[model samples]
Target: MKRQFAVIGLGRFGGSVCCALIEQGMEVLAIDQDEARVNKYRDLVTHAVVADATDEQALKHLGIRNFEHVIIAIGDNIQASILTTLILDELGVEHITVKAQNDYHEKVLTKIGAERIVHPERDMGVRLAHHLLSKNVLDYLELSDKHSIIEIIASTKMSGKTLMKLDVRAKFGCNVMAIKRGREIIVSPQATQLIKEEDILIVIGADEDIKRFEHEMFDE
Candidate 1:
């Protein structure tokens, strides 16, 4: 059976996480104090509950500790967010992922034993900066502080170049992990495989190498 999960606080970040989890076929319970917000996603998740995350009795009633993972995405209310995380920790929730409003909030979450903390707004800002620099950058994912995986639309200049001809690994120090052509995906493509116009390339490498590849090959 798929692992069950719960998301507390139906704000932007929590709502997005719940939607993505549901789309991935997970059993997600969306929880929020606001009835309107809970009703908004009533049909999107396996369950939507209107309850106060800070109320220990309410969480226990929902069997919050039984879920494999529970995400606390409370908005700007730092104290409530921390208290909810602390309560989850006390209840022995399997895994707790909390959204931090800022650096200070992250530190507190860390101190409270949060398994994972996400700074969604800050991360999105970083992704947006890269998009503004290039139109071909369809998406960007940071793998580490210095490495990333990025998606780009294969340009007309690269439409006919085979992997052997372009030699991104040898020249730009990046690896094309896969190519998406229309509805088909070619993963771990052979060197003889050629690029086609409108194809999407999923490339991974150090941030600097990716920048060089984009400027020299894709953008130029």
Candidate 2:
């Protein structure tokens, strides 16, 4: 069976989620209060409807709880967003992801049982800043507030060194999850595996430890 996903609000973020989910061959229901927005996506998604999400009866009528995952992407209308999330929570939705407009919104959503809260603008900025901060840092993915997984291009200075020789766990407190060389990727790369220049290393650890590793390894 295909996974069911519902996205509320037809803003940029919500619309993007619908498109991406549909691209992945999943069933997506696009919901928005604006009839135009709903009609625009009618042909693109599995289902599209215009309804006031804050209305509990409306959500119930649509069987919102049946969706495996629901995303509350109402922009600007913080009150409506909170109310929608509350209704989803009350209905015992399996998973709820909400887009937060600010820190206060995120706090309120957390208190009301939102399973996931994303600050896309702020998160993308942080990831971009980290990429600009180091020559080796290719990408950054936040695992949590304090932890992250980073993809780093190994430099010549660290080439020819095996994982055991580098002692990343002991020295930098990060674990190498995988190493991508050309077209092949080594998952859970062995400690005996040597890192060559240009190899992409995927590592995960506390954010502070990751920063220390970057500074010590390439800050020169």
Candidate 3:
């Protein structure tokens, strides 16, 4: 069965989520107070409606509680975001994801029982900064506040060495979860897996451990 999702506020982030969810074959209901925004996505999504999500009666009329997941991506307007989230919670929406404009907004959303809160702009900035931090650091994914998964392009120093020889886990506490070589990807690479120059390593560990591994392997 296809999952059902409702995205409130058809701004940039909400619109992107709607598009992505549609691409994944999920049934999405797009909502916004702006008629133009609703009309823009009317044909693209499963359903699009211009309604004030802050209105409890409006939400009930739309049967918002029926969706398995709902994302409140209201932009800039913290009060409306909070009110919508509160209403969704009271209406028994099982999973609620909210986009927060700032730390204060995030705190209020958390208190109102939002299951997930995201800072898209801040997160993208962090990812971009990590990409710029090192030439070898190709990508960074935050798993938590302290842990991350990073994709690093192997250097000449790591060439001709096996995972066992590198002893990365013992020395740096980071795990090389996979090795992407050209067109092939080796998931859960063995300890004896050979490391080749330019092979992309998917490493995961605590932030500090990842930093230590990067410095020793790439910086030095």
lDDT of candidate 2 over 1-220, digit per residue (tens): 8899999999989999999999999999999999999998999999999899999999999999999999999999999999999999999998999999999999999999899999988889988998887878899999888999999998776799999998999998999999999999999999999999999999999999998888776655
lDDT of candidate 2 vs native? Answer: 0.93
Per-candidate clash tally: 0, 0, 0
| Tens digits of per-residue lDDT for model 1, 72-137 | 999989999999999999999979999998989989999997999898998898889888888899
Off by over 4 Å in 3: none
lDDT of each structure? 0.93, 0.93, 0.96
- Expressed as tens digits, the lDDT of each residue in 1-220 for candidate 3 is 9999999999999999999999999999999999999999999999999899999999999999999999999999999999999999999999999999989999989998999999999989998999998999888999999999999999888999999999999999999999999999999999999999999999999999999998888986
Considering summed lDDT, which 10 consecutive residues are worst modelled in model 1? 211-220
> Candidate 1: misplaced stretches above 4 Å?
none
Best-fitting candidate, measured by TM-score?
Answer: 3
The candidate, 1 or 3, that scores higher on TM-score is 3
Candidate 2: count the clashes: 0
